[model samples]
Target: MRNASDLPPEAAEASASGVERRARWLLVLLAGLLVASAAYLLYARGVFEPTQTLVLVADDAEGVSVGMDLTFSGFPIGRVRRIELGGDGYARILVDVARRDAHWLRESSVFTMERGLVGGTRLRAYTGVLEGPLLPDGAQRQVLRGDALADLPRMVNAARELLEQLKAMTDPDAPLNASLREVRQLLQKANGRDGVLGVLMGNEADRTRVTAALDDVRRLLQRLQGVADRADALVQRTDQRVFGAQGLADDVQASAREARDLLVGLRATLQRVDGVLAEVHGIAVNTRSATQDLDALRVEVEATLRRVDGMILDIQRRWPFSRDAEVKLP
Candidate 1:
């Protein structure tokens, strides 16, 4: 409550109170601004709203950072929150996707980081099927990595090998040169009067031999064709003799008439056979009755034989005949 000018000289010289007051106001203002800025950043990052967390595991986290934007179809939808090394030696990137944008990520979605040869790397999200189920919270997915720089070495090696092979093949002193010389010789031979045949056979004597062989083959082919023609003519003649209208038909008609007469004779014979069969049936009935009587007689005879056998055994036992001797009946 003291006046401003009534302060001590030493305190005035130091200007301690004024400096302390200014510092307090400045701190308060800074604190307020920091809070406001944090709130704005949280809103911008979609942290104030509900979100789902997704983890993307990658072999290398090269160009990614926290709070980096995650774009979907060229639209920003999420941001990376944290990156940690998992126990399995992979980097796990935690991303917070807003609820509204979460629908864009399905279970079938794939994440990839495509690195260009001359430009910055890109983090792309690919949802192959829009009708698939939505990705659940805390989903762990593997991120595919593509690097143009990584494949350059292998491509260069393969190209270098291909170029070396081409160089060897095109060399003037290579085996290909010998083949070219042979081709030139063949072309020159083709322009000669002997033509390609002379080039292949190498001389007139060999060419004459080949020509003779060809003539023999032509003659053989002509003979074969003539034989085939004669065989076809013979087949036609056989068909005319065996199955033509005037040939087999006439024989068939004659045979049919003979068969008709035979059938008429067979009918008359069948009448006589029917009378004989009637007599045979009557005899068969009588034979059946006689067979029954013979069966009864056979049974009686068997019984009599058994009785006689017993009497013979008794007689033999009373006489005490030798085992090998056959007794004669008195």
Candidate 2:
């Protein structure tokens, strides 16, 4: 703690020089550290990195400000650098996207500014197709704004309406309550002695009558069913007698075969008769030739006999009862 005046002149000068040199060195070190820190901060902020400019136009930029992140798929790829009002009274937000993240943006990319109920406003980019054409530098695009608070009134109104409806439904005189009461009454009626039948008939006496009528109908149906069963049995017996192994169809077929055989035999007999008639005609011709005066009479008699034979043949062919009809020639 000696005073500077109590020191020797030379010693004091040397001590002061040393102190000046140390102070200068300390100042230099501090200046270097400050420069390094500033450079690190600039690098971290991506100030020197190459980036592309994107301008987003919006109707309102209430919650959007400079340094706000623009996210893609929840990752920050760009940051808002400036916000200005346009001539059309719209907000123009300028964003600087790093060159590496610029590839994620395409011509069809969509940008949105969303203000939620519980969080700060978010600026988001959506790229549906990565293979689409690249978005050029300084591209100006419209941003869709979504504000959750904008629909608050409508949602409140809807909720109020729902509450009112719930209150009305809870009222004793409400239609829903009335329907519930009717259903409860119906359930009580169903639990009565006649059960659902009493509920349907509306009265105990009517329910009893309906039950009796139902029993009567059931008995009548059973009787009719029994009668139908008997009729079916009779019909089955008749069917067995008429259309079983020795059926009427088989008998008729046998009779038809026998009739066909008779017809064949009759045809053969008719052929033989035709031959005998031919022989008779030859004999008549010979007789007529031998007796010239009786020729005309023989011819007339022969014609009449031919007509009678034809009539007998026709009757035999037409008559179903005369199956054994035979023509005997003299």
Candidate 3:
């Protein structure tokens, strides 16, 4: 064998040619691998597949961006490829859907763009009926927008206007403030010693007069009560004097009983005297020989008359009704 440094020129050239060929083969393999990887990524992205185009129109595309996915039931069915301002001063969003997912877009499908508090804007599609016809190619549809932050300015403006109105009403020269001052004055008057009377009368002197009148009425009522008590006591004493035991009623009753007994005794005595007179008349009519008896009878008769006179004197002393003691003979 020849030494390596002593190798033939043809052998060295052959070895160099082999190395060049291996290096070229390695370069070609790497290039082929890079192309395959790029093709596979494109195929995965659906660049090679057929698709349907849809155009969405909106008033504003504030958060909507290109390449945003259009979803149905949380699954991505299409992507936003472009956004442009239309001639009618509206935003237009272009979308492309793979042919396999294009059936999810129907003729009556609805599309919307919603911005949330947590994430970027989202595009959504809704189909109410699956039995409807499929959406056509390059169809233009209206997009509805729901922005949570949109209504804040109008609500804030309304609240600010309400606050301004409240401030105006509460100012020092406002009607409400004037009314409050008047009410405060009324309350102060009502809190006086005469209370509501002071507020109504508008003068302290008048309130004092009213208080004095009330005091006089109360004193008058006390005086009346004292007079009533005295009257009641007087009436009770009068009743005791008129109707109680050994009172005026008893004295009058005793006097009436005594007078009746006296009248009855006088009547009996007068009857006896009348009987005696009748006997004397009968004797005078029967016998003229009875003259002596008549004379004796005259003496007895005089005695009886004297006794009747003494009885009259006793009656005048006992009863004393009349001063004239005349006894008429009939």
Q: Largest lDDT belongs to which candidate?
A: 2
Q: Which candidate is the best by TM-score?
A: 2
Q: Alpha carbon lDDT of residue 80, candidate 2? A: 98
Candidate 1 lDDT tens digits, 74-139: 887778899999999999999888999899999999998788889776677889899999999999
CA RMSD for every model?
Answer: 22.2, 9.8, 20.4
Candidate models: Cα lDDT each: 0.90, 0.95, 0.90
What TM-score, to 2 decimals, does candidate 2 have?
A: 0.65
Segments of candidate 1 deviating more than 4 angstroms: 1-49, 55-59, 65-68, 71-76, 81-94, 104-110, 126-142, 187-192, 199-203, 241-245, 259-330
Task: Report the lDDT of model 3 for residue 37.
Answer: 100
Evaluated against the true structure, the overall lDDT of model 1 is 0.90
TM-score each candidate.
Answer: 0.54, 0.65, 0.46
lDDT of 3 by residue, 94-164 (tens): 99898999998899999988976568888999999999999999999999887766777888999999999
What is the Cα root-mean-square deviation between model 2 and the actual structure? Answer: 9.8
* Residue 104 lDDT in candidate 1: 93
| Candidate 2 lDDT tens digits, 190-284 | 99777999889888789889999999999999999999999999999989878889988789889999999999999999999999999999999
